[model samples]
Target chain A: MNLFSIFGLGGNSHGVRKTESSGKEEHFTDTYILALVHKLRTPLNAARWALDSVIHGDDTGKEAQREILNEGYNKIISAINTVNEILKAAEMDSKDGVDLKKEKLNLCDIVDDILKTLGYLIKRNEIKLEYGDKCNPTIIFGDREMLDLSLTNLFDNAFRYSPKGNVFVALTREGGMAKLVIKDDGIGIDKEDMSHLYEKFHRGKNAKVVDPNENGVGLYATKKIIEMHGGKIEVDSELNKGTTVEVDLPID
Target chain B: MADFTNKRILLVEDDNFLSELLSKKLMESKANVMRAADGEEAITMVKANPKFDLILLDLMLPKVGGFEVMEAINADPKIAGTPIIILSNLGQKNDVEKGVSLGAKKFLVKAILSLDEIVDAVAEIIK
Candidate 1:
């Protein structure tokens, strides 16, 4: 017999109902996010352990060594892509979120460091890599983790989509901008797909044909990483030909 | 030299993916590997089977962490002083220090140590 009865026991004041609905939605979203994280991480964590053992020599080079190496590396790459997707999704929802500590480091050295993690994958795929650097050994200010991840995502995409072609990585500097170019000759993207290419969860038409389980987060994350580093990402592709991605980051 | 061929190892980790991959790797090394999905299982397995020679423990585990497993291993009279190495993705400076203090002989980050390195570390520690 209170204000509730007087208000017909249903309608609420100005903000209460909206806030409650938003809170419930947020709760469900968080739970879904946590579950996604677990699902994405399981295979990757396992692959890392396997790689650790294989590289550490705990497991001898037996008959299954090469096979395990191949499978583990692929799974790890897939897991990494999944995690990146989750991060990108989260970052999209939160406007001011996840501040990063930027540092000055040589791009060549960063690329070299990422190469180690990717050695097994490159070997398994048999993709010939042609790499060169025209940029000076100058330092740039940016988040090292994001830089590494950006490079990884680029290289992983090249490897994943182009299993039979040569993948190329070239670095150069022009007008105070450090440019990184990655090109792969495999199943290229269509002009229509190019518009939404960097959109989260938007796998290109060719991507679906090349790999059914493609989550379409690599390029999106790559774009985000570039933008976060005060940069821009561009792409050039033609179906049944190749795809070239160019990212330019300012040297601060 | 002690015949370490076929010696059992207690591997504790919370990451299910890494656990399965590592178990397969250890099995390939001919070291009859026993895997625990978490710290609780690790302790239970170690207590139930006292024949394990080395313990490869991951630092981050659900329910019980690597330090707790290390303490449990140290407290048990049956398996005291057994070699334990901390393998983890949590390779921060403080995490390494804590693992060392908890009785792990060595700590290696996953990114730094490849699968081959892990296998090598196990062989060296057990041997």
Candidate 2:
């Protein structure tokens, strides 16, 4: 849908040019809207990037500062989650439904690409970041960007809470649906937190370890993105042990 | 070498407050700063003084847009190679990609960055 024609008020309305129908005004206005959207999203993207950096322990062996690095990473993630919630509230139509441009995508390849871009984080944390080869070029129908962002948030979370443990990402096919599994041996959530995991601003007890004002919204946004793609997310975890998040997405 | 110290920079932005604040910051770097609230004035000013070392552009402008200004500058030989860095609030992957492909050297999102960061980016790019 051309958001410009739909969201923009007509020329008859206020400062808009009605007589000069060059579409130049419309085009320029559309560009401005696009720019504004990007402007607003950049900070969120930066926060995600910054968090990923801290979680994956991208800095040199500054073992003494690991605690600060870990806390900073978690705080950045919290900030990104907060921004995502704000965007979700503002982009009304976008939140409820996602117009996923589905294509035949290889799940393994996609995960590889995401990890490669984020290699710095993986290497810095000394955490193992690898996917099972069984993924087998799975074809799925979903918006690539939405899928990537969801995966990024999940993997990022796994890496942050489990800095000293291995982070395993695996993909499996079952019952005609593809499942992406991200597991981590970090500070897993208590059973109590799982109930409100998908609720915006709901944070676990350990969330305060990162920031005092923690708004646990990352999983919520990730859940929305997944559901919008016609997928389901299930979490199985135990405090102090590990957590596993399984995303079941349709194969197109 | 072309001296960038006294050279003027054309900043085209719609927001008056930001325009003034940014101009003041850039001026502190010893560069004579000129303001164009819209694209038309930007184009006219560039045409008059093609010697500008840099063009700090905003993606959103009133009359003419940043891309249009870029097109105009790129079409002319005099200011063709002048460094053009996008100082915009638009930092989306696609938007930043488009600006760079259209000759913008760097794209900075305004909200996440401060005036000092902008000045530093300008200094580094111009240098």
Candidate 3:
């Protein structure tokens, strides 16, 4: 099962609904451009203001100055990453898909690396994570970097949306497929937004309320990557309750 | 040069980093800064304390938007008199016109203006 089948997107998964009239398409294009502008502008604004404060401020200690400079650097890095994500998405949207370096990978190692990278966020948000005991060393044939990016997006969403909440992750092999499940007791999706979950630049209303800074590109890119790996991803969510995302990949 | 001694200002911004930087800059100008991270809190604070010398508002807020917060403030005669300068990244023509029509004293795009310039704008309006 592909992303189109899972999300009911029906051939136009890139957010342009070909069935709509020309006027609606134009509106969609305008809205998309506006959203993109807002996304790119935010980090730039933050970085500029941080540097300006450092330059124009008076009686600031060295420690505080260093902290502000670090923040500015991080924002610039974030902006660069956003640009890279946009470029990757554009590449995937083209007729020629993204070029991936395929290799044999252990899913467990990828999960561990991602979790280690997210250690700071977990500590800061006070999230309780449950994993490893139920996880088996599942092997898969795919691009390690692409799979890493996709899984990181999912795990990041679970952590970002569910601060101070509980997350349960499990991976096991079932027949010819390796199944991975991530469940978070975070703000779940509204029923109205379920159908549009995988659409490009589409953010749920509740998600916007929780984290307005999100550019809504994570899931879109994640779905495309998963599809390229010949994997199936499914999500089950209820408003205010929690979310459960299951990904199934063919075993090597 | 921008002296806003004892002047009270309300800052309505959702981004934590930008809010902290702006608040510090405003405080450096000798202004008392009060912050509301979302539009709902901004409206509530404005209604409760309507004597602010100026308000710095961001448009794309969480619970409610900046424009709606301004509308709510305008609905109340006491708070409506307070000056508002919009601090937002959205600088489209329609957005500017809407902010102006909603009684914002100045519409400053965050990405375009420096922190000092924003504080200067606040001081200019309040003075």
Best by lDDT: 3
lDDT of 3 by residue, B1-127 (tens): 7888989999999988899999999888888999999999999998888479999999999879899999999999887768999999888999999999999999999998898788778877988
The window of 10 residues in a row where model 1 chain A has the poorest summed lDDT is A7-16
lDDT of 2 by residue, A91-201 (tens): 423424445667777777778877875665576557876666555878887777667767777886787677668888888889889999998888899888887676543
Q: What is the C-alpha lDDT profile of model 2 across B69-117, one tens digit per residue?
A: 8999899988787788887766678878888888888898776675566
Each candidate's DockQ score against the native complex?
0.11, 0.03, 0.78
- Give lDDT tens digits, candidate 3, residues A117-161: 888668867899999654577889999877887898899888888
Residue A39, candidate 3: C-alpha displacement in angstroms: 1.0
Clashing pairs in 2: A39-B89
TM-score of each candidate's B chain against the true B chain: 0.89, 0.92, 0.97
Candidate 2's C-alpha runs over 4 A off are A1-89, A92-96, A133-135, A210-216, B1-127
User: A1-252 in candidate 1: lDDT tens per residue?
Assistant: 332222121233211132257567455444334434444544565576555556654445676567667767777777776666565435533536447679888987887777677876687668888986444585689888777877787877787777767988888888999888889897888888877776544567666544432344446567777787788988898987988989888876
What residue runs in model 1 are displaced by over 4 Å at the alpha carbon? Answer: A1-81, A133-135, B1-127
* Residue-level error in angstroms, candidate 1, position B10: 35
